[model samples]
Target: MKKRNLIGIVLLLVLLLGILPISSLALDEPALNSKKILLIDTASERTLIDRMADARAEPASLTKIMTALVVLDAVDRGTVSLDQNITASAAVLSDMVEDGSTSNIVPGETMSIR
Candidate 1:
């Protein structure tokens, strides 16, 4: 079996073992982070607790949220047309063309953000 499949099965089994939805658990307790944590009640559209949430070093995972927000905002404002092409700037390429992290975009490549 592929490593990904094995990991997925393990995660699925773990999920199945838990009855309560993950989102509910967050409202019941504060995450033990001496660093940073933010809890939001999605159903109520409110923040339950926040602690140094924005003070951390920017992790690569957080970039996806920023990218999603930017894309959503652009879409909502119609600033970025669906047919428009965006060239990967050299700066963006240099930042992404690293071993550990990347957007997997090469320099000079044109991407349709739509």
Candidate 2:
């Protein structure tokens, strides 16, 4: 009975040793933290650097230029004309003043394009 118990303990140790190595090898690789980015030279029309630039958090105000381009295109296509006069009613002026949009247009003022 003593010999049987010693043999059982040795077999258990051998099984645990075999399983430990397999589990260690199965661990995932460490994650990559770095990302690649591009920098361009406007005058040369080429890539100045092909490396990671400063990390940007979020895109802000990037579409404003595109919005301006679309509005200009609409005006150029005659969908809008400079001769069109816009009157600032009390409601429009109040909203502009409340929202703090840049313009000196007063209430009840008539505005025409130059």
Candidate 3:
């Protein structure tokens, strides 16, 4: 399997097994670092743990993972290549937050998509 796919599976497993189990075990206890978190069983479509599920918060690193997944999907479909060099344009840099996490690329720096 591809490395990206393996990484995605590993992340999902860590969420479903490592995090989800501990999150739902305590309702009276209030201890969490995430602004928004939710775990829903895909087979049954049941929500297991929901914390601030309706709140709108900046995604931070989650967006990186999501972008990787989308790009990997495109690569699998032959729509995008891992060797392609992507240059960050001004419009892309315009979305950056001063104190928040964003891609480590500058507006002009170019690097392989991989």
List runs of model 1 lying over 4 Å from the truth.
1-35, 38-58, 95-100
Task: Return the top candidate by lDDT.
Answer: 3
Q: lDDT tens digits, residues 45-85, model 1?
A: 89887788788455777778888788888988988876788
> Which residue window of length 10 is worst by lDDT in model 2?
55-64
lDDT per residue (tens digit) for residues 1-114 in model 3: 699999999999888786566667876856778767898999999998898899978776778889999999999999989999888797878876687664476788888998
lDDT for model 1 comes to 0.77
TM-score of each: 0.46, 0.30, 0.53
Question: Per model, how many backbone clashes are there?
Answer: 0, 0, 0
Please give the ranking of all candidate structures by TM-score, highest first, separated by commas: 3, 1, 2
Positional deviation of residue 97's Cα in model 2 after best superposition, in angstroms: 5.1
Model 2, position 58, has a per-residue lDDT of 37
Model 2 clashing residue pairs (backbone): none
